[model samples]
Target: MIGLVLAAGAGRRLRPYTDTLPKALVPVDPAGEGTTTVLDLTLGNFAEVGLKDAAIVVGYRSEAVVERQAALEKKYGVKLHLVHNDKAEEWNNAYSLWCARDVIAEGVILANGDTVHPVSVERSLLDARGNGQQIILALDTVKTLADEEMKVVADPAKGVRRITKLMDPAAASGEYIGVTLIEPTAAAPLADALKATYERDPQLYYEDGYQELVDRGFQVDTAAIGTVSWVEIDNHDDLNRAREIACQY
Candidate 1:
């Protein structure tokens, strides 16, 4: 199985901080002598999960990010491949993910570059492979769901039956922890659906493609990661909070 780190976004919410540097390179905790960048932390976590071969989809000052990650590969002996997204700003994360579609096989873990989580996504990947499911998104029921965060709606069985299109500040109950374990065999069909949707309605969110599969009776299960700490850097406020979490470990 291969691990894909999606770091191609322009990070509009992060503003001036991401103006010069990619969000993955932003230092999460600087108080300690051995402070690590979000990218480094993610790599460390992936290493812990026993995922040594990885690829990063980069954009928005990709040269700098590539250089830093190259040094990391040399220092850690991890295979870090960089795939550039030339039009990252025009597209959403799903499109960025498509940039690396050729490399990702049937058993692959798709992770957001700006995320750090306590749980190893390796187990989720294993579960998906063993089950031979089309898709399995790692979900955590947050105590408080914020207005701007991505939310999920599951069935009474606690499975993610639908990813809601309605974006309301009051309708959310669960938050996605930036880890989506995808089956490579489902990639072709899923990507085809996404292409059709994107061509017809460019404004539609990427998850709409997944929902289409769900609506068609494809088994897109929700694997719950109970009591795990995870953070996705969206803005400066999130950065500060992630810094606190980083210091705890």
Candidate 2:
């Protein structure tokens, strides 16, 4: 499976830092003797898991990635394919993902570009492969649930029951860490589901597309990544936390 990163969001919350750069390009840590952005860590994780190629959905500040593409490829030893999303600033990630419909058939391990987590999270997803699992997610069952988290509820005997960011924190089973393994067979259906999702509401997130899949009888499973230090950088505070935890990896 190839690595896929949804890096198109214009994280307006990260003001000056995001003025000319996308959220994925926001510097968060100093690793390997260089100031590494969130995208660097994500691509590094993919390489650690033996995924030699990755497609990153870019927009908002697409030229920044284009300028650094060769260096990023050389650093991670992973070929970079930039997937441009024309509507990244106008629409949400549900539409951004639909922009990558062509590469879905390659069976991708999708990671949100803004999340800073260890390679263990990706390893957990890869380890849970087979057994007919079509859509597998990396879940943080150990994290303290909060309103801002992208939460989930699941059935142990079945699979994910629901996924949304607007749910009651008390009712959630865990938080989705924005990493997913989409099996080859599930690609076309997922693409169609994503299309229907964005068409229904252009502002919806890609997680909403997973909800659409579940609503249509698709089984979306989860892999618990026990305890891990991970953060989704949306603002200055999150960037601070990311720097603290990312160095541990």
Q: Which candidate tops TM-score?
A: 2
Residue pairs with backbone atoms closer than 3 Å in model 2 (clashes): none
* Reference-based TM-score of each model: 0.86, 0.97
Please give, for residues 160-223, the per-residue lDDT of candidate 2 as tens digits.
Answer: 9999989998999899999999988998989999999999999999899999999999999999
Q: For residues 2-105, could you state the per-residue lDDT of candidate 1 as single tens digits?
A: 67787777676887767876777777875623347777777776676677778889988787676687678865556888988876767666566666777566
* Ten-residue region with minimum lDDT total, candidate 1: 119-128
**Residue 81, candidate 2: how far off, in angstroms?**
0.8
Query: lDDT values of the candidates?
Result: 0.70, 0.90
User: Model 2, stretches more than 4 Å misplaced?
Assistant: 30-34
C-alpha RMSD of each candidate structure in angstroms: 2.8, 1.5
